[model samples]
Target: MDIRQYIDSTYLKTPAMAGTTIKENNEVVRSLVNEAVANGYKLVMVRPEMVAFVKRLLCVEKSKVLIGTVIDFPEGEGMLFKKLDEANKSIYDGADELDFVIDYKAFKRRDFEKVKTDVIECTRLCLDHKKIAKWIIEVAALSDKEIISITALVKNVVLTYFSESDYFNVFVKSSTGFYKTESGKPNGATIHSVKLMLENSFPLPVKAAGGIRNYEDAVQMIRLGVKRIGTSSASEIIAGEQVSDEY
Candidate 1:
C-alpha cells in the first residue's frame, strides 16, 4: 500500500503548548506542513486558526497536500451554533477537510435528537461547501453499545442527506487523541472500537485516529479498510520506526 497517501500528517497543538505567540505556533505548523509536502502525505491537519497560514505556505511552495482542521475539538459539548461558526471560519480559511467532534455526552444522555441535529448541521455545511466532513466519536469515552449506536446514527444521517457519489467526502473518525480518561485506560483508537465503527458506519469511510503510533499499526488499520490514519508521528511511521509521540 502507498502508506503516505493513507496518512494525514498531523499537528494540532494549541498555542500554549507550541508557544504563547501566533508566530511561534505558525513555526511549528510550518514545519509540519513542510514535512507533509516533502513526503507527499495526504493532508496536513492543524487548528482552524492555522489553516490560512498552511494554505498560504503551500500555495507559495507549490505543494499539493490538503489542509484539514478540527471543530469543537477534544470536547464535543460546545454549543451547536458556536461549532458551526468555527467550522465556517475554518472553511473560509481554506481548510479542505473538517473533523468535527460529535457531542457524545448528549448521545450518552439518550438525547438522540440533539445529537442528530448537531451532526446534520455541521455535515450539511461541509457538503454544501464541497469539503470532506469527518465525525470524531472519541471512542475511548464511549461504551461498546454507545459506539455502535453513534456510528449507526452518523451513517443514517449521511445516507439520508447525501448520495453515494458523496460518500467519500464523509467519514466516522475514531478520536481526538486528547480526551481525558481514567487511570490505566487507553484514550484513543483501539482495534475493537475501530471494528465497531467500520461495521456500523460502512458505506461511509472510516478514519482511525489517536494511539496509532507505528508503521505496523497503521498498516493494520489500512488493511481493515480505514481510509485515513491521523497521527503526529507520520514521519516515523513512514520510516518504519516506533513513534514516541502520544498523538
Candidate 2:
C-alpha cells in the first residue's frame, strides 16, 4: 500500500512542550511543512498558529498537502463554545482539517449528553466550513469498554447528524500522543485499542494516531482498516528506521 497518502505527518508540540524558543519551534514547523511538500504527504498537522504559515508556504510551492490542526489540543476540557471557537479560528487560519480532542473527561464523568452535544455541534461547524473533522478520543486515557463506547458514540453522532456522503470527511482518531501515564505506559495508539476503535467506528473511518513509530506499525494499522495514521515520525517510518516517537 502507498502509506504516504494515509499518513498525517504531525508536529503538534509547542515551544514549551519541546523546551525550545518560539522561533526554534516554528522553524521545526516550517521544516515539517517543507518536508511534506517535498515528500508528497497527504497532510501536515500543525498547531493553529502555524496553519496560516503552512498554508502560505504550501500555496507558494503549489503543494497539495492538506493542513490539519488540533482543537482544544492535548486537553479536551474546553467548554463547547470554547472548542467551537478554537475550531473556527483554525479553519479561518487555513486549516483544512480540524482534529478536535473530544470532551472525554466529561464522558468519563458520565456526562454522555455533553459529549454528544460537543461532538455534534463541533462536527457541524466543520462541515459548514467545508473542512474535514476528526475526533481524538485519547485511547490511552480510556478503558477498553470506554474505547468501545466512545468510538460507537462518535459514529452514532456523526451518522445521526451528518449525511452518508460526509462520512469519509469525519474520523474517530485514537489519541493526542501527549497524555501522561503512570509507570511509563504507552500514551498512544495500541493494536488492541485501535481494533476496538475500528470495530466500533466503521464506515466513518478511523485514524490511528499517537504511537505509530515505524513502517511496520503504520502498515499494521492500515491492515486493520484504519484510514489515516497520524504520527510525528512520518519520515523515519517511511525510511524504515526507528522513530524517537515524539508527538
Candidate 3:
C-alpha cells in the first residue's frame, strides 16, 4: 500500500482539511488553520469569512499559501447570483479554489438543465477570479440511475464550463454534516460510488469526502483513484488515528 509514487510531493507538504461549515466562528477557524500551518499542513478548506485571515497568515512568503472555501455550501438553496457573488468575494479574500454543492433538490427533481446551468455559472465565477471550481455531487444520496444521469450531465457541464483545464473536477461527497436524519451518522465515502464513477470514465477528478478519518481509509480512497480527499479529521489522520475528522 505504499503510495510514494502516486503521492504528489506537494500533497504531503500541504494536506487539505475541509472545515465544513459556513457558520462556524471566525476566531476558531483561524486558530485551527494557524495551528495546521505551523504543524506543516499547507492547505485549509475554510468558510468564506476565514479565508482572508488564513490568507494573511499563510501568504507570508509571497508564495500565497493555497486556500479553498465552499460555494453554494452544504445546502444549495441560494440564488445563482448570490452563489456567484459569494464565490467572487471568497476569491478576492484569497481563496484559491471553490467547492460548490450542486443543488440536490433540483437534481432530485430531475432538473438536469438547471443543475448544468448552476455548474456553468459557478465555474465562470471561479475562473473570473482565477480560482479552480470543484463541483460536489453528493453522490451518496443518488440512486444508481441518478448517479449515472448526474455523471453524464456533469461531464457535459465540465466540457462546457471551461476549456483551460482539460478535465474539470466533481467531488463525490457523502453528507454535509447536517441533514443526516436518515443515515444517523455522517454519510461515509463508498467504494461503490467510486467504482461507478471510474467505470463511467469521466475526465474530471473525484474527491472522496464525508467519513474518511485515518490513513487507511485515505489510502483506500487513493487506491480507488480518488485524487483528493475531504475530511475534517485531517489533523487526526496525519496523527495516525482511525476515526472521523468531523470534530
Which candidate, 1 or 3, has the higher TM-score? 1
Q: Is candidate 2 or 3 superior in TM-score?
A: 2
lDDT of 1 by residue, 76-129 (tens): 899999999999999999999999999999999999998899988999999999
Tens digits of lDDT, candidate 3, 1-247: 5432222111101113334443345555655665555554445677776678778877663443467787777778678888988988988898887778878789998776778888888877766666677776676677767766776677677676567364643443333544353745346456787667655536777766666667787798887787766666665675677874342
**lDDT, candidate 3, at 229:** 68
Which candidate wins on lDDT?
A: 1
| Stronger candidate by lDDT (1 vs 2) | 1
Candidate 3 lDDT: 0.64
lDDT of 2 at 7: 86
- The local lDDT score (0 to 100) that residue 230 gets in candidate 3 is 67
Cα-based TM-score, every candidate: 0.97, 0.97, 0.81
Instruction: Give candidate 1's total backbone clashes.
Output: 0
lDDT of each: 0.91, 0.91, 0.64
Q: What are the runs in model 2 whose C-alpha is more than 4 Å off?
A: none
Q: Find the 10 residues in a row with the least total lDDT in model 1.
A: 17-26
RMSD of 3: 5.4
Error of 1 at 49 (Å): 0.6
Off by over 4 Å in 1: 19-21
Tens digits of per-residue lDDT for model 2, 95-201: 99999999889999999999999999999999998899999999999999999999999999988988999999899998998898899888888999999998899
